[model samples]
Target: MNENLQSSIEFSHESGFDPFMESEFHDSLKKKNPDIVINLISSGLHKSSEKYAEIFADIGSSFINATHTSIAINESFIKTFKDKKLIV
Candidate 1:
């Protein structure tokens, strides 16, 4: 390959693992790196998180509350539970 062509190709390949462009991860690129992500996470939860926490906390909160449910599936166990009970 010509030197210019090789250099161009290499340059195009140089931006690696940009989490902003990739939505497959649960957390942002900053969040993936604890040092940087913590800043984005905030010392206190965001308004939406706080609102939801308040709504749910009145009922209950637990890490294992929905361990068996699939968050991605439509009509998942979580959806069914939510439909069945206002608090669930």
Candidate 2:
């Protein structure tokens, strides 16, 4: 009984419950706490990604995006982030 199956699905920021607006969030984070640590859990997104790179770039955040549709860690990116002093 897929009553509303005909209804369309749209792509928009509001589609997901991501509360952080990226820019504003980073600005506030900087003003509110200077030494705060951000541990981003991501997948397939990087500094070159159009969808999430902007958010990651903000607040100097680092991440570990992965592949294979599993929760496995992206060791390379993680190591790089740690090496760059972005995360511990």
Candidate 3:
């Protein structure tokens, strides 16, 4: 995972990103917005299946700052994987 992340960071930098951001952040968003805290839900520890996880992801934090607020647009897909490594 570390190697993959490093590769990603390097790729990002090479692609013109001044500095790649960290994958994980211990941000205190809950304290900042108490309303969104109770709604905190863990995805899972580890996964062996992608069928259930391939739906949608909260990728807003990747580019937006959650300090005071956040915004994101959803790109939905209705197709399922049918090739190798494809999940039901």
Candidates' lDDT values, in order?
Answer: 0.31, 0.40, 0.25
Using lDDT as the measure, what is the rank order of every candidate, best first?
Answer: 2, 1, 3
Error of 1 at 64 (Å): 9.4
Give the TM-score ranking, best first: 2, 1, 3
Instruction: Quote the positional error of residue 46 for candidate 3 in Å.
Output: 13
Candidate 3, superposed: residue stretches over 4 Å from native: 1-4, 8-10, 18-79, 82-85
lDDT of 3 by residue, 3-83 (tens): 833443333435464432323221222122221111122334222112112321122111221222211222221122222
TM-score of structure candidate 3: 0.19
As a whole number from 0 to 100, the lDDT of residue 69 in candidate 1 is: 30
Tens-digit per-residue lDDT, 14-57, candidate 1: 64644323232222322323211101223344453333333333
Clashing pairs in 1: 30-37
Best-matching candidate per TM-score: 2
Total clashes for model 2 = 0
How far in Å is the alpha carbon of 78 misplaced in model 1?
Answer: 25
Clashing pairs in 3: none
